[model samples]
Structure formats: C-alpha cells, structure tokens
Target chain A: MVGKHCILELYDCDHAKLNDEAFLRTTITTAAKRAGATLLNLITHRFEPQGVTGLALLAESHLSIHTWPENGYAAVDVFTCGDQTMPEQACELLRQELGAKNHALKSFQRETPAALATAVRHPKA
Target chain B: MVGKHCILELYDCDHAKLNDEAFLRTTITTAAKRAGATLLNLITHRFEPQGVTGLALLAESHLSIHTWPENGYAAVDVFTCGDQTMPEQACELLRQELGAKNHALKSFQRETPAALATAVRHPKA
Candidate 1:
C-alpha cells in the first residue's frame, strides 16, 4: 500500500519546550492521536547537555521528533500508510504546540511497485 | 545539526524474507551497525494476513521498514544526524540484504534554520 510522508522543519520554537522530555513525549502522543494514528509505543532519549529525540511506533507507520533546543529548532517526520490517517494534521499540531514562528514542510507520497514502475525518473545528480 | 535522510523503495524483493519478522529484525540491526550507528532499541509488528513493520531506534536517529510481501515491495526510511554516520550505507546494505531486484532511493539533507533560509524554495503545488 502507498503512504504519505511529511518532513517538517520547525524554526524559532520554544527552546524550553523542545528540551523538556515529558513535554515532547506528551506532544508526540497527542499529535499521533490528533492525526488519527494508533500509537503502539513511544521511546525517547534525552541528550546530556540539551535536546530530546522521540519516536512513536504506530500501527499505520511512525512519527518522530528531533530537537535542537539551543537553536530553537526541531525536525519532525510523519509517515502513515492507511487512507484513514492524516499526517499533515500531525505536523500542524506539532508546529502549534512547539510554538514555531515559521516552519517549512515537504510532503510526498510513497508509491507502490506498480505505480513506481510508471513514475518518471530523475537521473542521479 | 543537519542530518541526511534517505527514502528507499524496493521492488521485486524476496517475499518470504520480507514477511519474516526474525529476518527483518536481524537485517535491520546489522544494517545499522554497518552504517556506524548505535542501536537503541527495535520495535516490530506483523500484520494478520501477511506483512511486517519494523522500526529501529538509533542513537544517530532512526531506521524503519514497512513491507507488503504480496506485492514484493518494501519501503524503508533512514535518517541520521552527525557526520560520523552514513545513512546511505545503511540504505545500500538494506537493498542488498533484502535481495531487491530493483530499487529507488531519494536522499536529502535536513538543514538547520540558517541554511534553510537561504535555500531555494518551491511553491506549494
């Protein structure tokens, strides 16, 4: 089955929130629920100085967040396979919850083999 | 910090191997090690009819696979931060281990805010 993947770059986020382990864990869980994804489990790691990385395993797929608190930045990935889920919704929730001033988002569809066969190819750069 | 992200699409993979949970778990762990990434933990789930989804939490970042055995296709994502780790190496190892006849890969850098500001922008489609 094909799926949708979103790569979100959040800029000028709240540094404190980004570094808070509990906050990130909650935010990701909430974001997954908001996106209509079934959260299987969440695993997080807090860096020594400052920073947090969190991943949520979903039945549909996964959602992850990696934060650079010093720069007020965070990178998020949301990929979900069934049509019932909306990955963009998860991105928006993260943007708002993380207090990002400006964000860049790239969304693309993962194609199945049959569709990929017919898809246009770009020569390796 | 900027990180490299690779989106890999495998076609004509070995169906039995794709559906095997144990094989995927070992393959992904070995692939991560080959890329010089430290493994944190791995979580996997197998679908009812025939399919498998596995995610490996790495100290550098994460690696994930979602397979559709009946279609002989598997989708993989590998994202890692820091210059020490090579995400592409992980992708190549997976391509070989999965026995994919043909594969498509897209690689991009997730830039920090400063670099993102000056980078070319593509208007929404």
Candidate 2:
C-alpha cells in the first residue's frame, strides 16, 4: 500500500549529452536497472534541431526524461509501485550521469489501495 | 519557456475499466491528439495480478499513466513543451475518460531556454 513517485526538474545538465539521443536512450535504461526495475522497452525521439525525449517502460512502473539541450534542462519522472522500486536512487544516479548541477524534486506517497478503494465505493455526494 | 506540465493523482477511478489495457491505450492516444500533439507510439502492459501501465510517446514530449485498479487510483503525467501543446486540456480529457471522481493536480512552468542556458554556463562553484 505504500509507494512513492518523484517528479524531477534537472537543470544545468551537460548540453552535449542531453542533445544526444543515443546517450539518453542508454542512460535511462541503465537508470531503470539501477533502480532494480525490470526494463520493458525504451522509446526515444530526437526533436528537429535539438532536444530529446526518452521513455522507459518498466515492469514496476515507468521512468521518463525530456531534455532541452539548448536550455541545458531536463525533466524527469520516476514513478514506481511497491517498496522495491527506489526512485530516489535512480534520480540521483541520473543527476550524476547527466552532469546536472541543480535539481528540484517533488515526491509523494501514493494512496494506499484500501483507502482508494473505499473512496471509489463510497463516493462523496 | 512558458509551457506547462500536469502531475495528476486521479482517485475514485473505475476499477474494472482501469484494468483493461486496450481502453487505456486508445484513451491516451486520443488524449494526446486532444492536446494537439503528434503521436509517435502508444505502449501498454497488463500486470499479472491487476493494474495497467501505458506510455504515450508523443512528438511534443510524453504522456503516461500507471493505474492501480486494486487501489482505484491512477497516476498520470502530461508533459509537453512549447505553446502548441496544451497539457491541461489533455489532463482534463483523461480525467473524464477514466471516470475519476476526484483528482489532484500540480502544475509548473518549465524553466525557459534562455534561463536554463544561463545556469549551465554560469554554474555555481
């Protein structure tokens, strides 16, 4: 019933690596493995002149990154269910791998199954 | 620079429908289109016991949802860059499609390209 989700704003990332689609594709896969999540598939797309977006579909949940190389910023999300998935560790690893100097993180504890189920069954009128 | 991202916590979702994979896939794809995003691919997976995870790889950025049908809750992320992509509209469409009775949303203005570039070049020592 206890789980966590981290929404990350990574700034001052290495402009070069952020612009490299291959690097982002590989980095996210490694990040997911680092978090101990089973990787399902990694999808990546490189924008016209710059920027890259990568999404890692994982067995536990999902981790995604969208980078604006020209801006040296990347937005990352690591959402996992259960206690086994360590999203914070994955976020830290990515900050280091991407050479980001500053970041803002928002973390939340997902609602327990029992609590959510009850709300659905007994909706507020 | 002025773009937005919506981090949504959807509660009181339809438990039965949340477990269905096809419905989620199609819903997300349509959600992206509703946001004026060009779809790249939509990937979905059904868990062993229950729940579903769907990721929409959009040309603008990405949209993803992780459902805990057992919990009657779902986590949705709508991240899109530039003025052309309307993440709020997409989030609203999803709230309706999922039949969520209540939801919490967190929105933010992504750092501008010029601002992020400045931070990278002038890193704090």
Candidate 3:
C-alpha cells in the first residue's frame, strides 16, 4: 500500500503525572476519533514506578506510545495506510494535551509493496 | 537515539491455520526472546472470524504485527532504539515462523531528536 507514516519522538514533556495508563488510553482514543479514524482495539501497560506504554490499532493504521516519566521524555509513532495528514494532526493533539515541550517529529512516506518486492527480487542483478 | 527501523509487508502467505491468538502470542514471544531483547509486556487482540494483531514492548524497541488470513497477507513493523541490526533479524525469524512468501520490506533510519527539533522550530523561517 502507498501511505505516509509519522514517527514522533517527544522530549521534555512537562506532564509527567499525565503519563499514566488511564490517561494515555483516553488521550489516544480521543485523538484517533478526532482524526476520523476508527479504533479497532487498544492495549496499555503500566510499568510500575516508571511510566506507561500504549498501542492502539486503528482502521487507518496504528499508533504506539512509550513514556519515560523520569526523563520527562516520550516516544510516539503513528502510521497510516492512506491519507497522510491525519497522523500529523493526531500528534499535535497529543502534544497539546500532554503539554509537551522541546518536541521532535519525523515523517516518512512508505514505499509501495510492489516496489519493495521488485527491489528484493532483483537485488541489483 | 540513532537507529534503524524495518517495516515489513508480507504477502501471499499460506499460514491460515497458524494465525490464531495463542499461536501468534507464542511465536512473537519466541522471536523476541531469540533476538536477545528484553520483554517489557505484550498485548494482543483477536479479531473474531478474521485474524489476529499483536504488539510486543521490547527494551530494544517494539514489534507490531497484523495478519489477514483471508487475503493471505501480513504486515509487520520492527523498530529499535539504539542498535539497528536486531530489527532485521527479528523480521527474518517472524517471516520464517509465519512461512511468509512474496514479501516486501522497507527500512528507515530515524532522524536524531535534535535534528527533528530544529526542523520543527525553523520551518523555513
């Protein structure tokens, strides 16, 4: 499939208290819905005395987040199979909701499956 | 952190019988273990009458997989934080375990956090 994927590495987030499992689940679900995406299923893990990690499967693609409360850092990856803009919007919502600062974000345009298969088979021969 | 990420889109696989929830959990767990990565926690979802999706949190990074039994296709994303080589090895193990064919794979090198932050701040200013 042809699509855009965004991988965001959020750093120096101010909301350490907001990085709990319950908060992440709510934030991710709301962000996905606001982006006009459907949520298939979600799983969240609470690493005791550390931080929370969450993954949400969307009908569009997927979103994964990992938090480091002690370091005031968080890593977020949002990938979509079709349109590219929604992932950026979702990241903005997340940054605003979590009060992140000194943020870092990266965008990637994924290659089509056919192109990848061709490269693999040929291998510069 | 600078690292490599491998996103694999496997197609035309013939493992319909192996796509159950239990089998996926075992296979993914085993693959991660053999890669010398630390397992944090895992969450899997079973789409009844369809297929399975799983996400494993690894100290090295993360692995997410989605299967479409009817279409004989699967999508896997493996990402690492520090070292780049482990993700590829993990993907190979997954492909072998799932008996995938006609596979397509894409590799990405994530930008450093500082670089991303600069780009965001400048934005052609």
Local accuracy of candidate 3 as per-residue lDDT tens digits, A1-117:
344677876766765554567888999998787666777778776664566677887765578886666666667888765543378888888888788876888887654444323
The parts of candidate 3 lying over 4 Å away from their true place are A1-3, A15-18, A82-85, A109-125, B1-4, B15-18, B82-85, B109-125
- Quote each prediction's TM-score: 0.88, 0.84, 0.74
Task: Please provide, for model 1 over B21-113, each residue's C-alpha lDDT reduced to its tens digit, 9 standing for 90 to 100.
Answer: 999999999999988998887888887677788888887778999887878889999998777789889989989988999999999988666
Clashing pairs in 2: none
The per-residue C-alpha lDDT of model 3 at residue B68 equals 63
Q: Name the best candidate (by lDDT).
A: 1
TM-score of chain A of each: 0.89, 0.87, 0.82
Model 3 residue A41 lDDT score: 75
Identify the superior model by lDDT, candidate 1 or candidate 3: 1
Report the candidate with higher DockQ, 1 versus 2.
2
> After superposing the true interface residues, what Cα RMSD does each candidate give?
12.5, 10.3, 13.3
Question: Chain B alone: TM-score in each candidate?
Answer: 0.88, 0.87, 0.82
| B3-121 per-residue lDDT for model 2 (tens digits) | 47788888888988898898898889889999998788788887766778899988767898988788778888888766678898889998999899998888887554455333322
- Higher TM-score: candidate 2 or 3? 2
**What shift in Å separates residue A26 of candidate 3 from its native position after superposition?**
1.9
